[model samples]
Target: VSLQELMEPEAGTNRTAVAEFTLLGLVETEEMQSVVFVLFLFAYLVTVGGNLSILAAILVEPKLHTPMCFFLGNVSVLDVGCITVTVPAMLSHLLSHRPTISYGACLTQLFFFHLLAGMDCFLLTAMAYDRFLAICRPLTYSIHMSQTVQRMLVAVSWTCAFTNALTHTIALTTLNFCGPKEVNHFYQLSCSSTQLNELLLFALGFLMVGAPVVLIIASYIHVAAAVLQIRSAEGRKKAFSTCGSHLTVVFLFCGTGIFNYMRLGSEEASEKDKGVGVFNTVINPMLNPLIYSLRNTDVQGALWRILVGRWSLT
Candidate 1:
């Protein structure tokens, strides 16, 4: 159905129907817009290329076929999706004098963006649990994190993410707009009361962001405890090192995501918020592959094999 059908006012209501939304994207001045556009374009390219390389390395290398690597591949795909949903459109808008997006396009972007973002949280929590099992219960790690279990975790993550994104998108569609439909980080375009939307966002944000964060924290707590019980300092260090890349990514993603979503009461997007948005949307995705590659010997070796023509599906 069309956006008009979805977003039409009630029969008695006198609200203006919003056909499109003006995107006051990060910068205002032409000079700054050009500079931001170039930087974002470069960042987008790097993010896509880096994530693709990670996916290839995981697929090509037998050594990197563990549950951790499986989840890493999923993360790479989500990172690519997350960046793609927003950056390309933003880049095109940067070039336009009037950077407006149709109501349908805006909602579509919101759906995919939130879907992937929610998956990021759930997948990270899954990865954290994988690490916890490997470190804390090594004897049962293989049994608990079998191929079947891994796929189930991924399936659940995707299901939950789709539900969360769809809920928000549907909630937004129920609101009626009067005027001044400007979308910045999030669309607050409705002249109608957004109390339901805010409440819904807060509730699902807790489920998608807060609960996963708590689980991640709990998993790491157990992991730390298990690592500390190791007799050798080298063994403890080695155990903790396994978590390095995942921990870094968790901090970067959860930090910005919590700041952006948790404060549903705020209406104004500050400079700090925009900067955080850029980092979350663009910089963070590019860093994921780098973090995994540099910090992970298996991924590095897999990439090296591909680079040197030794990689084979066999």
Candidate 2:
């Protein structure tokens, strides 16, 4: 049997299976290409440097050895993995103007992209829970979020993200891309039409993405309620201060995700839609570490200490 026959058993006619796909990159202007290349290159470097520095600070600093920092470390790792999947290839495509990506590489990129994104969602919800427990149940927080329990939570987050990505990968593998080999976005692996794969993607989004968003919303609701219960002005101010940074990060990440994937099956998407999609995938990962570091006093202090220590040794 031919590859097309193998892919589509019910089809009465035969067709050619697409072996390669062309990615339509962000812009086609020759003058703009060089400018975009330099700008994206700078963004990519800052992304890698900021995330790695955060990870290093968390690891080397004893003061940051807490559940929150542990989760932050995982977020940093996810950010690095997320950006690495798309930015380098995107940069290459921008510079070379040859937008061909192999089937295997495309799939690999899609897999890691979804994996890291799902992991970030899970981790953010986990962080919200951590903050909730710290504020609401101060005395029992340590007991509830013990080392073993925290480790288990992190492990479960990774496992669920991997499984979610695997489901999509398997679904895509079953699809037969027989025509329209040009992908109208920066990536090609996401364009295949396997009903099973799309359904799986929707299912994973509902369970992993939808569920966590609900939990995050519920968490902040409770957090807001708790903050309101505080009678003293000082107490309310402190509570709000504690939550402001996390709330900002959560809104930025989840807002983009909801805008991108929530409208996936809709017919309203256009080239501007794809541009927004690319923005979330490429820019958000870079922004996460910067937002956390610049806004969170704990992270900033840890980063400063690390810098000072390094300078002293040199």
Candidate 3:
């Protein structure tokens, strides 16, 4: 059925209160769908397992009980949540004859997706702030970023993110999706239906999205200044090394996200935007644990010890 047909249900009947929405799936062809199904499933599992491993290592090992590791554990948990919200649903719909999601479930998905993704942004910013303290203000870092303070910051970020998600959800629900129930992309939203919301989301999203990037940049600028003042070249290298992983993550997470949303504003990027969406939602989550694990000596040592510990036990 053409999109026009879905938009105009028999003129006599009312379709304002849509019961459900049909997704267009990832690719056009059935064969492509099967391939995407395997790919997405593999990505989801790796994302979950890798993040869980990060969490497990932190939990069993006492050395990882510091403020940095604690916040990282929170990021791992959010990464798991971030992927779970979309990938499982996308996977279920990938090969189904009727790729549909009910109204409430769809809205619920939108809510949690934003909630967790927003938390990811804030948490990264918080991590940058933690680094700022640990590096720039080393002596006062312990006093300023105590366990209680760290926990409180994390709790506040969650609360704020939850509230931000709720606001976006409310704005979305304000629009009545009475038109075509078929969502052209993998997710469920008729393009024509969301034009208004898309524009609004971008405008509002500047604060949600732009604020974090700005904050991260500002934090790093201060960090650079602090590093430059270090008398020894080795000292500066060590400081930058501690921050390298986080900066890489921030770029990967925000760079793809910005591209995806920027594409939302144009019709030409319809298909390409889907690819960007997949990158941010699926690929980014999977990469986060890998980035931290590979970049940090602490995570590497912990994982090594963990493997040997289990190996000896068995």
Q: After superposition, which runs of candidate 3 have C-alpha atoms over 4 Å from their true positions? A: 1-15, 180-183, 186-200
The lDDT values for all models are 0.85, 0.77, 0.79
Which candidate wins on lDDT? Answer: 1
lDDT of 3 by residue, 146-196 (tens): 988998988888897888788878877776555444334433344346766
User: Candidate 2, which segments miss by more than 4 Å at Cα?
Assistant: 1-14, 181-183, 186-193, 265-269
Once model 1 is optimally superposed onto the true structure by TM-score, how far is the C-alpha of residue 222 displaced, in angstroms?
0.8
- Go through the candidates in order and give the C-alpha RMSD of each one to the true structure: 3.9, 4.6, 3.2
Q: Once superposed on the true structure, which residue ranges of model 1 sit more than 4 Å away at CA?
A: 1-13, 179-187, 310-314
Higher-lDDT candidate of 1 and 2: 1
Error of 3 at 174 (Å): 2.5
For residues 150-259, could you state the per-residue lDDT of candidate 1 as single tens digits?
Answer: 99999999999999999999998998776343434554556789999888988888889989999999999999988988999999888888899999999999998888
Question: How many residue pairs clash (N, CA or C atoms closer than 3 angstroms) in each of the candidate models, in the order given?
Answer: 0, 0, 0
As a whole number from 0 to 100, the lDDT of residue 280 in candidate 3 is 88
Alpha carbon lDDT at 268, candidate 1:
62
Instruction: Find the number of clashing residue pairs for candidate 1.
Output: 0
Error of 2 at 221 (Å): 1.4
Return the lDDT, model 3, position 175.
68
TM-score, ranked from best to worst:
1, 2, 3
